[model samples]
Target chain A: MFEERLKEVQDAVEAAMQAAIAAFPQSDLRDAMAYAAQGGKRLRAFLVLESARIHGLTDAQAMPAALAIEALHAYSLVHDDMPCMDNDDLRRGLPTVHRKWDEATAVLVGDALQTLAFELCAEPVLGDAAHRIELVKALAVGSGAAGMVYGQALDIAAETAATPLSLDDIIKLQAGKTGALISFAAQAGAILAGADRAPLAAYAKALGLAFQIADDILDVEGSEETAGKRLGKDADAGKATFVSHLGLAGAKARAAELVAEAVAALEPYGPGAEPLRDAARFVIARDK
Target chain B: MFEERLKEVQDAVEAAMQAAIAAFPQSDLRDAMAYAAQGGKRLRAFLVLESARIHGLTDAQAMPAALAIEALHAYSLVHDDMPCMDNDDLRRGLPTVHRKWDEATAVLVGDALQTLAFELCAEPVLGDAAHRIELVKALAVGSGAAGMVYGQALDIAAETAATPLSLDDIIKLQAGKTGALISFAAQAGAILAGADRAPLAAYAKALGLAFQIADDILDVEGSEETAGKRLGKDADAGKATFVSHLGLAGAKARAAELVAEAVAALEPYGPGAEPLRDAARFVIARDK
Candidate 1:
C-alpha cells in the first residue's frame, strides 16, 4: 500500500514540476531549470503524502505541500551537485544540471528552484495564515543556511580538517542536510492534519534518523551503476560514514534498529501510522 | 541629519554582522564568513534606514530591517562574484571571497548569508508577527528566483547571445535584479510604519527606478579608482546597459529626471520626506 501511494505521489510531483517550468519564460534558464528539477526519486513527496494519508487527508488536499517538498529536494540536489560543492556529474541516471550546462546556469536554476519552494508553500491551499506561517518557518529552517547550509559547511570542513569527527558530528551534519527536510516532510503533513505536537514531532525525528541511516547504508553497498553516481565516495574522501564507523553488518543492524525506533514512535497514532511504518522499512530495504 | 542617521544605521548593521558570525563555532567558516560580509557600500542598509526616516521612524527602530537588507545584498554580491558566476576578483576594493578562500568556501559563505537574512528578519526587534511576515515575504521575492534570480538568469543569457535588448527589456531585467530589493526596502519601511498601501507603493516604485538610473549613471561616469572596482566592464563584456543604449549624456539626463520624479512622488509626506529627497540627489549626483 505504501509503495502504491509512493508511485501516486511521484506522478503528482512530476506533473507539478512540469507546471512550474511552464510558468517561467523560455530561455537557457528553462532548459537548465527543467534538467535540474526532472529526476528526483520524490522520496520527500511520498513522505509528505503518506504522512497526510495517516491523518486521513486525501491526495488532493496534500498535493501542494508535497509539491513544495519536492521543489526543495530538487533545489538541494541542484546546489549539491554544483562544481564547488558535492560536484557530482550524475543524479538518478541523468547528467546533473552543472554537468549539462555551465555552472552559472546551474546556480540560477537552483535559485529558481528554491524560490519555487517558498512560492508553492505560500499558496493558500495548505492551511490558514498561521499554518502557512508555520510551514514557511519549517521549510526555511530545514533548507536554509542555519540548517542545511550549516551542514554543508561542516561537510566541507570535515573533508579538510585533521580531526576525526565523532558519531555525533556525523549525525549532526546529516541531520541538517538530509534530516531537516525529511523531518519537515513528516511534520508538515502532521501540521496540515492538525495533529498534536507529541505524535507529530516523534514521527518527524525518528523517521528523519531512519532515512539518514538508510542513505549511509546505500552508500556502502550500492554500485555506481545502481546509484547513478559515484559509490563509496564517502570512504574515498575519508569522510566518516556509518559503514566505515560501523562495519557493513553493523551498519545494516543500525538501520534496522533505526527503523524499529521510527515505527515504535508512531504507536500513539495506532493503525493510522501503518503507511509510515512501511516507509521506515522501505528506507532500509531500498536498492537505490 | 541624514548623514548622522546613516552612520548610526551603518554602525548597527556592522554590529549585527559581527554578532551573526560570532554565533557560529570558531573555524575557517568564521574567517570566510567575516571576510565576505564585513565590507560593502551599505547602500541597501541606508535605503532601509532612509525609507524608515521618511515614514517618521527612528534609526533604532529601523536597524534590524536595515541589517537584514544588507545581509541579503552582501550574500548576493558574494555569490555573484564567484568563479562559476561573474568570476570577479575584486569587490569593495578587497579580494573577492572566492579569491581569498576556495570556491567551495565562497559558495558556503553565500549560503550562510542567505540564511542570515531570514534570521535577522525573524528577530523580535522587527516588531510583531504580521510585520515579520511582511519583511520575510519582501526579502524572499526581492532576492529569490522569481525576482533577482530571474533577472540574473536573463542577464547571463543576454550576455551570451543577442545584438541588443530593448529599453523595456533592460528595465525589466534591472527591475528584477536591482530594483526588486530597493522597492522592498521602501515598502518594508512603510509596513513598519503601518502606513497605507497607496503612498507606500508609490514611493517604492519611484525609488526603485531612481536607484536603477543612478546605478546606470555610475557605471558610465565613475572612474574605476573612485568606484573601487572595474568600471565600463558592462560595455567591455558586450552586455547591454542603460548608458550604452541612452549614450553618456542622455543617461545622465535621464538619471536626473528619475531623481526628480522620485522626489516628486514623496511630496505627500512633506517634511517627513526630505532625507529621501536628499538620497535621490545623492544617488544621481555622486562622483563615485
Candidate 2:
C-alpha cells in the first residue's frame, strides 16, 4: 500500500514539474532543465507529501513545496555531475546535463533550477504570505552556505586532506550535506501549518543519516544498472564512509537502528504517520 | 555628488555583504564566495535604495533588498566567469573565483551565493511578510529561467548561430539578461509600499538598455586597464553588439537618448529624482 502511494506521488510530481518547465520559452536551456529534472525516485517529494497529509493538508496544497525540494535536488545533482565536480557521465539512467548538452548549458541549467526552486516556494496556494516566507527562509537555511553547500564543501575538503575523516567528522559533513534538506522537507508541513515541528524534525534527522548509510552500502554492493548511476565511487576514491568506518554488516545494523529510531519519532502522530514509518523501513531495505 | 552617494552605497553594501558571508563557516567555498562578491559598482543596490528613498523608506529599511540584488548579481558573475561559461580570468579588477580557487569551488560559490540572495530577501527588517514575499517573487522572476538566465542562454546560443543577432534581437536579449533585474531593483520600493511601479519600471527599462550600450561601447573603445577586464572581445569574436550594429558614435547617441527617456520617466518624482537622473547620465559617461 505504501509503495503504491509512493508511486502515485512520483508520477504526480513528475507531471507537475514538467508542466512548470513547459511554461518557460522553448530553448536549449529549458530543454536541458527538463531533462535534468526528469527522473528521481521523488523520495524528497514523498517525504513532503506524507508529512503534509499527516498535518491535514491535501496534495494540491503541498505540491509546490514538494516540487521545490525536488527541483533543488535536481539542481544539486546537475552541478554535482559537472566535469569539474564529480565528472560523472550518467545520472538517473541517462547522460548527465554536462554530457548531454555542454558544460556551460549545464551550469546555467543548475543555476536556473535553483532559482526555480525558490520561485516555487512562493506559490500562493501554499498558504498565507507569512507561511510562504517562513517556507522560503527555512529552505534557504537548509540549502545555503550553512546547510547542503557547507556539507559539499566539507566533502571536497575531505578528498585532499592529509588524513581520512573520522566517523564523527563524516557524520557532521553528512548532516549538513543531506540531513539539512531532508529535515527541511519533513518539517515543511509543520511550517505551513504553523504547528510543532520537533517530532518530524527528529524523524528526519535519523532518516537522513540512515539514507546516506544505505547509499554507501549500495555503492559497495548494488548493480550499476539498478542504481542507474556510477557505483563503487567511494571505494574507488578511497573516501571514508560509514561502511569504511564500520564493516558492511555493522553499517547495515546501524542503519536498521536508525530506521527504528525514525519509526519511534513518528509515534507522536500515531497511525496517521504510517506512510512515513513505512518510508523509514524502505530506506534501508531497498536494493537501490 | 552622485559619485559620492554611489560610493557610500557601495561601501555600505560591501561591508554588509562581507558580514553576511562571514557568518558562514570558513572554507575555500566561503572564501571564494566572499572574493567573488567583492568590488562591484553596486548600481543595482543604488537603484533599490534610491527608489526606496523616493517612496519614503529609510536606508535601513531598503538595505536588505539592495544587498539581495547585489548578491544575486555576484552569483551571476561567478557562474558567468567559469571555464565552461565565459572563461573569464578577471572580474572587478581581480582574479576570477575559478582562477583564484578551483572550478568546483567557483560553481559551489555561485550556487550558495544565489541561495544567500533569497535569504536576504526574507530578512524581517525588509518589511512585513507580504511585502517580503513580493520582493522574493519579483526577484525570482527577474533572475530565473525567464529572465537573466534566459538572456544568458540566448547569448550562448548566439555564439554558434549561423547569423549574428540583429538590433531588435540584441535588445530583447539585453532586456532579459540585465533589464529584468534592474526593473526588479527599481520597482522594489514601490512594491514594498504597495504603490504603482510603472514609472520606476519605465525608468529601469531605458536605463538598463543604456547601460548595455555603454558596456558595448566600452568593449570597443575603452582601455582594458580602465574597464578592469578584457576589452575588444566582442569584435574579436565577431559578436554583434550595439557598437557593431550602430557604429561607435551612433551607439553613443542612442545611449544619450535612452538616458533622456530614463530621466523623463522619473518626472513623476520631480526634482526629488535628480539623483536618479544623474545615475542615468553616469551610465553613459563613466569610463567603466
Candidate 3:
C-alpha cells in the first residue's frame, strides 16, 4: 500500500515541478531551477497532496499547493548546499546548484524559487481569499525565520558548542529545521480541506516527528549509494542525532513510535485518511 | 514643501513600525528585532507611505504596506552587512546586527525580518484578499532572486571583473538591487490608492531611478557623520555607481531629470499627487 502511495505522490511531485518550471520565461534561471528540483524525495510535496486527499481535495485542486511546497523545499536545499552553509556538492547523485553553476547563481536560483513558492500560493486556483491567506501564513511560519531559519541557526551553533547536547536539544533543533516545514505542508492541505485547527495541528505535529525520525535513521545506517548523500556526515561533524541520543535500537523504536502516533492522529478523519497512514508507515520504513 | 512631505512620511513610518512590533509576543526575538529596526533612515518605509499619500490612501489604510516595505529594507541591510556579503560593521551609526550579535544571530534576525515583511503584507487589516495577494506578489518580485537577488549577484560579480561598466550596465544593476524594491513600494501604494497599472508602473520606474541617484550622491560627498554609513566605500570597492559612470555633475543632473519625470507621471492625478512629487525631489536633495 505504501509503495503504491509513494508512486502516486512521486508522480504528482514530478508533474507539479515540471509545471512550475514551465510557468517561467526561458532564461539561464530556468535550467538551473529545473535541475535543482529534479531529484528530491518530495516529502513535503507528498505530505501536502496526502493531507489534501484526507480532506477530499482532488489532485487537480491540490497540485498548486504541492508544487509550492516542493519549490520551497528545492529552494532551501539549493541554499543549504552552498559553501557558506552545508557545503554539500552532491544531492541525489546530481551536482548541487552551487557546484553546477557558481555561488552567485545558486543564491539567485534559491531566491527565485523562494519567491516562486509564495507567488504560486497567491494564485487564484487555491480555493478563495481566506484559504490562500491561511496557506501563505502556514508556509511563512514553517519555512521562514521563525521556523526553518531558527533551526538553521541552531544547527550552526550546535556544530561549535563546547558541550554535548541532550536528546531534547537534538529534537528541538530538528523540530524547527525539518519538522516545522513538514508541519506547514500538512497544515496547508488541512486548511485547504477546511479542517479546523485542532486536528490539523495534531496531525502536523505527528507527521513532523515521524519524518525527522526517518531522516535520523537514514543518516545513521543508509549507504551513500542508496541515500545519494555522504553517509555518517552527521557523526563526523559531531552533530547530535537520534542515533546518538538513543541507541541504534532505540532510534529504530522511536521511529516506529512516531509512525504509530502519526497514524493515530489520522483517526479523526476516518477512511479518508488512508494515504496519510500509508505515508507515516513509509516514512519509518524507507531505506533512503 | 518637500520637507513637510518628508516629515509626514517619516511620522507615518514610525507609527507603522511600532504597531508591527506590537503584534509579536515579547521575547528575545522581539528585543533583537527591535534593535535591528531602530536604526535606518526609514527611506523605504517613507517611500511606501508617501506613495500611498500621493495616490490618496488614508494614513490608517497604508500602514500595513508601509511597515512591510520597511521590514524588507531592514532585513536586506542586516544580511548585506554579514561577513559573507558586504561585511560592513556599522550602519546608521550603530554596530550592525552581525557585529553586535554573532553572525548566526544576525542571519536569523534578517530571516525573521524577511518573514515579517510578508506577514505584514498578508495582514487582514491591509485590504481585501485580492489586494493582499497583489501586495505579496509585488514585494516578492521586488526582493526575490529575479529582482534584488539577481542584482546582488551581478554586483558581486562586477567586483572581480575587468569590464568597465557602461550606462546600461549600471542601470541594470541598480534597477535590480535598489530600484526594484523602491518600485514595489510605489506600485504597492498606488495599488492601495486604486491607481491602474500603467500610471503606477510609470511612477515606480522614475521614482526608483531617482532614489538610486540620491544614494549615489550620498556615497560620494555625504559625511559619515551625516549619512550614518561610511562614505566613499562605493569608490573604494570599485563597484559601479551612477556617480562613477555618469560623473558627479552628470549624475546630479540625471537625478533631477528622474525627479521631473516622476512628477510628470503623476500629473494625471493633479495636486493629489503632491506628496510623490515632493518625495521625488527630496530623494535627490536629502543629506543622507
lDDT of 1 by residue, B1-288 (tens): 766755666677788778877776566766787777886667678778777777777777877778778877877888789877788888888888888888877766776666666656656666665666567767777776667887888787777675778889999888888888877776777777767646656666666776776677777667777776667778678777788788878877887787777778787888777877777777766655
TM-score of each: 0.92, 0.99, 0.90
Q: Tell me the whole-model lDDT of each prediction, alpha carbons only.
A: 0.75, 0.93, 0.76
Instruction: Give the residue spans of candidate 1 off by over 4 A.
Output: A52-62, A191-195, B50-63, B124-131, B192-195
Candidate 2 residues lying further than 4 Å off, grouped into runs, are none
Report the error of model 3 at residue A34, Å.
3.5
lDDT of 2 by residue, B6-108 (tens): 9999999999999999999888888888888889889899999999889889889989899899999999999998888888999888889888888999989
Measured with C-alpha atoms, the lDDT of residue A143 in candidate 1 is 73
Query: Cα deviation of A106 in candidate 1 (Å)?
Result: 1.0
Candidate 2 global CA lDDT score: 0.93
Count of clashes in candidate 2: 0
Clashes of 1: 0
- Highest-DockQ candidate: 2
lDDT of 1 at B1: 75
CAPRI tier for the interface of model 3: acceptable
